[model samples]
Target chain A: MTSSFTRLLVMVQKELLELVRSLKLLWVPLVFVLLGVMQPASMYYMPLILEKAGNITEGAVIEIPQPLGSEVLAQTLQQFGTLGLLVLVLVGMSSVSGERNSGAASLILVKPIAVFSFTASKWTALLLLAWGSLSAGYLASWYYTGLLFGDVQASKVLGSLLVFGLWLSFAMTLTLFFSTLLRSSAAAAFSTLGTAAALSLLAGLLPKKLGWLPGSLSSFAYQTAVSDIANVSLFGWALACTFTLMAAALTGASWLLRRSSAID
Target chain B: MYDNFDFGQILPIIAPILTIQLVLVIIALVMCIKAEQTRGPKWMWVLIILFVNLIGPITFFIFGRRNER
Candidate 1:
């Protein structure tokens, strides 16, 4: 048991080293910071931007309402949900499949490490990358939001950030699962995105019944941001569902890897 | 509108964004030039990395490199 734990740790180190070598460790967080900064900065400068645009008629005034700090922060979360999520999934889409395609999986599988350790290590590294990037980007956004707009309560920001982080982790796990299941990284990314879209769409349409789904996590995050905490029970359920689904995806990925170590 | 607004005020607000973009572009360009094997023509990637704003470097990072370790 101790040996397997050590093996998992070693694999995690290797995966993180790969991230640094690929420059993902640097660029991903920067992209996210850029994304975070863009939201508040653009919102703050919208009126000026409109004034500068060529289409405006003479003497015409554009009135834009400044958003509250919490609203701006929520908008940042939305940006992360769409573009930030895509960046993460694409970055992680090849975690298992890339190695398998290059015959690296076989080489590593010949070692004494268990398949669970291999999958768990990849999951840990990807999750760490996702969480780190999110925190960096979120905190950057929070600081800017506080600077340009009024300050939001730190407690609210922390709560919503945790929920949003879970959503991103769920997406990363999906990427890992599909990467393990398919040889094509592109396919894995597409399917993972499609599944997330479908889940969110369904949850949106049937909020009363499906509100506990991980798809509702972003909305819960937004709620935690914009209003007082009202439905603590529902948030707990959504958190539980997301955790269960992430565990299931990890297990499925490990199972798939164990079943077919060298699909390529 | 132009009378009251100061362009200089905006610079400090956006300085961080510009710095991050510059760093990304420079790093991506260096990597593109140094890479032994890219998915497409190296010159094209260099152009893409130079011209594409925030997206250029990211596209190059994700899809450009062919011989990843």
Candidate 2:
């Protein structure tokens, strides 16, 4: 376990380099930032654009507030929770498979790096990148909302940001694990995305609360921003995040073991 | 989000995060450069990955990692 931990650290460092060097890294954050910013800006300005259209017939007009802090959080999260998370999954799917394809995995393994460590490092790096992108999107949304809706305060959105960040990180872990199992990045990405979609669907179908599931964070975040729903304590969120991250790492380890035994 | 780089509020949060990201990204970039791949494949791959970002890496990873000798 200790050796695996060290390997995991090294894996994280190595995988991080591949992520930063690539074009996806640039676009992933840029897209998320754009998504987060667009949500509030679009919401805040929609009413004005609607009024200008004068398309409403003799009926009550709906007015959208100049983005409340809650609304900003809601809008940003609505898109980020879906699109941003998907992008993160896509980014993560390449963590192990990319190196393996490039023959980098073999090189790393040849250098006293255990396969599990290589897997762990990739998972960590991917999750870290995903977390960073999520934060950036959160930041952008906060700023855009602050400018568009002057009534609400920053403190209002903090809970939502934190929870969503943890959720995104957890999702990244799953993606990395699946990437290791799959023979191709495309397959891994599709599988992860499909799993995410399925999880969301499952959450929707299950009338009861599925704590720590895909949509819970978004729900928790949105509620904290709008209602008096107390912001979830960091402990629960941290535990879930760590659980999912570890799950991904362990799943990958099992896959490595399976492959090694199969080869033998 | 608070104020364009609100030193008091946002900096504390973002500073550590940014520092970690910079270090990680630098390392990831180095690993990518040093990594070996098949001749025709690596160059083609570099172009694809550079442009496609996550999509390319995911694709190459699942499908291409084994083809290299």
Candidate 3:
């Protein structure tokens, strides 16, 4: 008997191709890299540009916080984080719903391909894309920051990046779940944004004591990673919440497929 | 030592990693086409092989290899 599961491997290969070939594939990472580059590049040069402007409205000597030391980092993360998350959102939107729209799912199902493979491939593809793009962004951002600040604390940048990665996983999961629920790309994309936004607001309405909820943990990471906020238990809860959300999302997708299969 | 990233130096590493993916893509296409085994138009198979290279090949092997149900 063959030891390796050629089936699983092949399925993964298909997913990577789908992602790599799409025009959006190029655009998604391009925009993300732009976000990474633009943030630090723009911020580092901003003061010089402003100084050259010669104070046209010379009424007040306004002191804008120069992006030095931790400040460079603050600006970088804030700009990149927001843009990167949007990229993640668009990626999650495309993952399943795009497959649905393209009739790839229907075409593949008629063959021997298992539905589980369908689900797994999508998750793997998005995760890998996230990995590649995030790593690239981090490296670029680090270099840019080093140019301004002597050198940033690697531990701090790594810690904050890890936390951001975790939060992004949740956002992707929520988007994936919505995509599976609604086969339309527009519906999947908007529902994901609306759902995340709503849940965050809703989490705020609840007591600060319940900080481990998915919504709360997502926000907590920014302060904890960048600003030295503490609560080991919150991080623990954050991990737990992320796993639960992912499990729930995958479970929901699986259940949806099974039911649809049955109905057909 | 950690700050040793020369933009020129990094390009070589990034290049091979990316090129490796292309090789993998071609290998995947071959596998998908072979497993499919039919002599008819392979446009659908080609798309699956070319488009969704990672998952597409596997999907083709598991789902697309056999005649459609």
lDDT of each: 0.90, 0.62, 0.63
Top lDDT model:
1
lDDT of 3 at A199: 64
- Alpha-carbon RMSD of each model: 1.3, 8.5, 10.1
User: Which model, 2 or 3, shows the larger TM-score?
Assistant: 3
Q: Model 2 over residues A1-264: C-alpha lDDT tens digits?
A: 797677677667656776665545665676676667667665754765576565887555675545456766776787887777766775566666666777666666667666566566665677677777788878877776676576455566666677667667667766777767776788888887787677667655652545446545556667766774543453365357557656755676556734752231
lDDT per residue, candidate 3, A110-184, as tens digits? 777667677777777777777667767666667766765557677777776777666667777777778888867
In CAPRI terms, where does candidate 1 land?
A: medium
For candidate 1, lDDT tens digit of each residue in A77-157? 999999999999999998889899988898999898799989998898899889989999999999999999989999989
Instruction: For candidate 1, give the lDDT of residue A84.
Output: 95
TM-score each candidate. Answer: 0.97, 0.68, 0.70
List, for all models, the DockQ compared with the true complex. 0.72, 0.06, 0.04
Candidate order, DockQ descending: 1, 2, 3
Candidate 2 runs further than 4 Å off: A1-10, A23-25, A51-67, A151-153, A207-209, A212-215, A228-245, A248-251, A254-264, B1-69
What is each model's TM-score for chain A?
0.97, 0.80, 0.85
Query: For each prediction, how big is the interface RMSD?
Result: 1.8, 9.1, 11.2
Predicted structure 1: clash tally: 0
